[model samples]
Target: MNKVPITVITGMIGAGKTKISNRLIHGIKGSNCKVQVLVYYPDTITVVEDISTKRQYRKLPHQEQPAKLITTQEQLISEMISYSKEKQPIDELIIELAAGIPPQFFVEELFQSLEKDMLDKTFYIQSIVSVIDAQHFWFDYTSNHYVIYTNDNDRMEHTFAEVMISQIEFCSHIVINKCNFISKESLDETVSFIKKLQPKAQIIFSADGQVASQTFHSVNDVDLHQIKSNIGWKLELKNNSSTLNLVEKFGINSFIYESHSPIQLEKLEEWFRTFPSEILRSAGYLRTYSEAHGLELLYFSQVGASVIIETVDEHCTDTTARSKVVFFGFDLKDVEVTQQLNQCLMENNNINQTVV
Candidate 1:
């Protein structure tokens, strides 16, 4: 039976993964192959639109930025399954996750979803291909890599390199992308790095995502043993403080604030509404009204803020891990701003509680 091939494309924030994916998708579609690429964040769509417009305004410059669309990871995978069921002779389905996200999340969330659907069908994941950024080999990466954009400091650490390494560790193929941006010496260094990470990966050097079109001509049938051997079921993070290292690159003026104290919901909202310019991104588990009710995850990205609410299992003893928040951005090290936020958290006593 003919099967659909799914490739999970992962990399760092500015590591050129999206660009490569876009180019590949467009190039494949231009060919006889039915190809589709998926993105997981709306912000990425905006970036693509902006870049496309910029390129057009620049009279179609040397780099014709490809179109990118952002959809949820689960939604993308589900769509792929549905599309495959129709017996569409598609060549490739590339799913691009946001930078700094753990691959295990992709495996458990997207892969498992596909697997569950496959229980009644023959759809299966064919390969996992990771894209690496050659230029910024020494930088750090995190989920907040591009959430806060700063000027004058280019050496910021992002979880990109680590994510690339993780993708290589668990995938069948690794594409060392953006070689054109690196020198011969840097190119050698990058290859050396990948060799130590995943020595067995089919490494490819891509120029503008052009892979001779023969790369996707053959689809490797799922080798469960090989997949399991490449991907460790138990995902342990060896580098926890890499984010801290990344933030320190911007002059090391960063601190995380945590308090069990109740915050006046309105005041906290107001502060964020007028939050200072230096604050890049802030995320954490927070108790809304009382410690007894349960907690919610507070997420603040460039787009906006959201509170992901779920029933907190009370049996868990890790309170500090919950009932906590972290703020990272530029000029956040100001004594006045930190003191002001601390005072706000402390002073808000009687709040019209919104249980989130």
Candidate 2:
């Protein structure tokens, strides 16, 4: 069975992502191939126009801003698979991850999760063609222009350059969209900068989105083995004493608290809901019931940490029942914050162990 090809289109806000997306869809339709295509728009931000009147884009199931549904690549891929499984003659699928996601925010685990499936079918990244608003690139990606308006929490997240560099490093193609507004010198310099970040990415300049179809062709037919070969792991977690060091580097320090003790269900749920702002991501397998046939809670932050539950296998030992959760951004080494959370999560005992 030939697995369908899926392309993930991503970009920052107002970078003309929707425009290029429509163009690609039309281009694919015009080809008149007997190929089936499904485009998964970021379930967070709403795009007003419909390219296909007959087949309305199926909105991914979510309660928050629909765009939020495209929160992680794994969720996007999982939803795509679920959708494709129900369709007949499933030929190809195209998904847009959404606007304004920093490169680090792209989950490494999600891609790893798909490595197995990519081998079974034709899976390719196609291209992560970021549309550059020439006029705003310097403002958004170079200077601290947008920081003045955001709250204290977001102000510490990432610099403009870091975000742009992250996106460029991962994208397979560089689409300098809406280039009519930029000077020739600026365009050359921008291209030079992108090349420094990712020399392998093919570069294309488009005015009103007129890039050739070949721009998308390089990644059109990728082998799963090739993708799997590119897989490697780089998780940065400093020793418990390095909280200050982590803070200096990432503006965040994370602590993972693992306890085998069975937390009270109501207390656990309440703690998850009222989690502090300093935590960027927190997750673990939770065991609260007697038999260990309980639920798992995953916590992560886009704007703030979100908690969700799913079933897990029965755990036999409460003595070995551990909750390893990380709290990023809160000065964990600070006797005040880490101690407070230690008291909060443990609630009744003295559990003071550092990242070391």
Candidate 3:
């Protein structure tokens, strides 16, 4: 049996993944190849349009292929396997993941299935396509809100910024949808930022998810290993490259803040309360010094209005374990910000000494 190619669509809650999937489905109307789409949403039902419906509300002579609604990962995999066994197997399959779920999680599952021979002869992942809302890209990307999902008695939550970054980092293609909603300058900046995030992915611009069908048809086979290691933060930290001169043209840049001294808990809290608006996203591991805990390692992350500092349970005494934080923002004053951070260090704090 011929293997069926699969394309996984991923994006945040208001991005245009559904619209893009609809467009893809419409393209298959006159083709000889059979196609199936599994729409996955944990919280609500998504109605995918049936393009095969006849005009004037009259029934069409041919059967309409409607998108199947899937609520769980197991169901998604089971449906794909079952579809492949049909008398007339589908030529291609599309899986539209929920906004709150990370693409990597599903990708990993698919790979595991392939290894265990569950999907090896039936289906293979062709590419990962991410949709972005051009108009609200910056705001949504930087926001600190959490994507929450509730199914009966089960509940789950994910950081909004983390989900946005993961979707961009893991995709093989990026669709910048709703282009007509933003100005030319804003669109350029949005593209520049995405390029920095995942420089390897091909970016396609569309006003209403009307991207060419050939765009999806001609995608190169994805290299899973490369995709896993293509994140911007990882590359930046590895190369020790502080700023991208090309991205600076749009007043957007990134830098790594590093220090060996421990940060005072009180000062760090104060800094977060008054975080600079220009610093859009910042995350790293840091060492904190408190009288009660002495020295401890903590994880720090600030995206838009959300700020998080939690214990990391790592040895802080190791000289090699320095505090390093990466900050990405617009028109950042690195030197000034560095000086301010220096003041928060334990070495710089004024401590009273009593001679006994």
TM-score top scorer:
3
TM for candidate 1 is 0.49
Model 3 residue runs over 4 Å out of place are: 28-31, 44-64, 86-88, 114-117, 139-146, 151-162, 217-221, 243-248, 264-266, 287-299, 308-320, 348-356
lDDT of 3 by residue, 189-262 (tens): 98877876787888999998787655766434567878866766656666676543337479888888888788
Residue 156 CA error for candidate 2 (Å)?
Answer: 6.4
lDDT of 2 at 65: 16
lDDT per residue (tens digit) for residues 33-80 in model 1: 777666665332222112322221212222233334655655565666
Question: What lDDT score is found at residue 195 in candidate 3?
Answer: 77
Native RMSD of candidate 1 (Å): 11.1
| Per-model tally of clashing residue pairs | 9, 13, 0
Error of 1 at 152 (Å): 35
RMSD in order of candidates: 11.1, 13.0, 6.9
The whole-model C-alpha lDDT of candidate 1 against the native structure comes to 0.51
- Local distance difference test, each candidate: 0.51, 0.47, 0.74
TM-score of candidate 3 versus the correct structure, residues matched by position: 0.79
